[model samples]
Target chain A: AQSVTQPDIHITVSEGASLELRCNYSYGATPYLFWYVQSPGQGLQLLLKYFSGDTLVQGIKGFEAEFKRSQSSFNLRKPSVHWSDAAEYFCAVGARLEGSQGNLIFGKGTKLSVKP
Target chain B: SQTIHQWPATLVQPVGSPLSLECTVEGTSNPNLYWYRQAAGRGLQLLFYSVGIGQISSEVPQNLSASRPQDRQFILSSKKLLLSDSGFYLCAWSSRVHEQYFGPGTRLTVT
Candidate 1:
């Protein structure tokens, strides 16, 4: 049923403070959002995507995201927090339902802690 | 400029051993291959995908199985191994939409 919801599984900021990580989606029509980052053994890294127009999307290290389609939401931002930007952040959803072969439906990540 | 390669980066077996994990993709062509699993820290679970050469598509069902004889090779098999099938095994590739390109993962430990 196309789902993605990352409601902060763990977050703690304080190194210049400023970060917002929350993503929500249910998909039915226009949706192909993504944001990934993993740095422990590394494997995922593609921090920005929102296919359509402009709703604020900029990624790669400094990170930035915003695609609010009537609040279906796609939020991930970073203003300052940096302790090497503690990793583990994912939010993905790409639906091709009937045509298939286009997979990506993930969410269950968000573990950031930067305090120093 | 595309690249994806997964191997035995780290593997430890013991229970009914019999498994293979190998994925390769270099620059692109009929590309769309995937096999993901991350059960230690969790997230990314899409067992298999292949859109050519032999056509295989499965999204999690059990003791692994995947193959794409050519076009950039992709193989993940298991004839007996299962200890809940270890964890952290990723290999990905894409050519459009939502972007996907990953590989530098393979940490299977079963016992």
Candidate 2:
């Protein structure tokens, strides 16, 4: 079965510092990957997605992700972190079945804490 | 632009009570709809999905059920709420391209 793994359970970084969240996926073929962020008591927001194109994909909220097929990883990065950026991040892989797109499988998520 | 909406932002029900959570989408047609559950400290688990009106596929066997009465309306229901059913339920929509858009989600607590 296809699965997504987020190695870090929690990360603490200073405001204005760089941030990177690691994600690895196990899939049979070229996988469609995505990053989503969720604030406390809020819904998940799409950060970035990679279907097919340049390895690097940019998304809302100044976030970007690089899809490394060799590593089977799609890591999310931000040049500078903000207090508002503190939230839980999830990595997901889209499942396709019988020539149609299916649901998604998500990682457990990583919680980020921004220190001032 | 497409938008998804879920009602009853938060719900508290006793065990054995019935449940009905509604989700709807606007500005799109023939879009795929889904229902997911997020347990505390866990990832989102897909509960059900619908490809079109009256087409429902369940991913897991649980006390919950889903229905799509219209093209963009999805409903999650349960005859008897169980303590284990308490979780954050999310509704999402996706186009043929497979990029999902999520709603604000509904928090259900069964006591």
Question: What lDDT would each prediction earn against the true structure?
Answer: 0.86, 0.93
All candidates: DockQ: 0.24, 0.75
Writing each residue's lDDT as its tens digit, candidate 1 over B1-111 gives: 887888878999988888899989998898888898899656889899887889988876897799999988898989888788988888888865537878988998889
lDDT of residue B68 for candidate 2? 98
lDDT of 2 by residue, A1-116 (tens): 88899999999999999999999999998778999999988889999899898999999999999999999999999999999999999999986556574678899999999999
Local error of candidate 1 at B52, Å? 8.0
Q: Tens-digit lDDT track for model 1 on A14-44?
A: 9888999999989887778889888888798
> Taking the tens digit of each residue's C-alpha lDDT, what string does model 2 give over B18-80?
999999999999999999999988889999999999999999999899999999999999999
Q: How well is candidate 2 docked (DockQ)?
A: 0.75
